[model samples]
Target: MQILLISCTQTIAVLYRHVLEDSYCLFCSISKQRFTCLMSRKTAEVTL
Candidate 1:
């Protein structure tokens, strides 16, 4: 019973870690796109 519990716990931990990593990656990508957009706008303003 203890072994089974330990395995289950480990599986849950792995799943949670995977979910967190995926969310973090998504956030990074969104922020990167926003950053690029902001930079481009700034360059356009300077050029004008």
Candidate 2:
């Protein structure tokens, strides 16, 4: 029973880690897109 519990805990930890990493990946992509848009707008303003 103790062994089973240990395995279950490890599985949960791995799942949690995956979720955290996925969220970080999503956040970075969103931030990068926003930064690119802001840069493009600035360039357009300078040209005008």
Candidate 3:
């Protein structure tokens, strides 16, 4: 059970890293409006 849990956690971490990389690449390719929208979302998160 402990080994299964460890592998599951590792898989989740790898998936999260891949998602972050993809999102960053997409963000870089987005236009000004999209960039501002993303910035606003980030600021909202910071406020929370």
Candidate 4:
């Protein structure tokens, strides 16, 4: 019974960690895209 409980806890913890990591990665990618877009726009304005 104790083993079952431990396994369940571990599974839940792993899943939670994966969710947090995924969300953080998504946010980082979005910010990176926005940053690149802003930089490109600035360059375009300078060229024009």
Index of the highest-lDDT prediction? 3
Q: 5-44 in candidate 2: lDDT tens per residue?
A: 1122333333444333322111111122121112212211
Candidate 1 structure quality by residue, lDDT tens digits, 1-43: 1111111233333344433332211111112212111221221
User: What is the C-alpha local distance difference test score of each model?
Assistant: 0.23, 0.23, 0.25, 0.23
- Once fitted onto the true fold, the runs of candidate 4 whose alpha carbons sit more than 4 angstroms away are 1-8, 18-48
- 3 against 4, candidate with superior lDDT: 3
RMSD of each: 19.7, 19.9, 15.3, 20.0
Candidate 1 achieves a global lDDT of 0.23
Pairs that collide in candidate 2 are: none
Weakest ten-residue segment in model 1 by summed lDDT? 39-48
lDDT of 4 by residue, 1-48 (tens): 111111223333334443333221111111221211122122111110
> What TM-score would candidate 2 get against the native?
0.20
Off by over 4 Å in 1: 1-8, 18-48
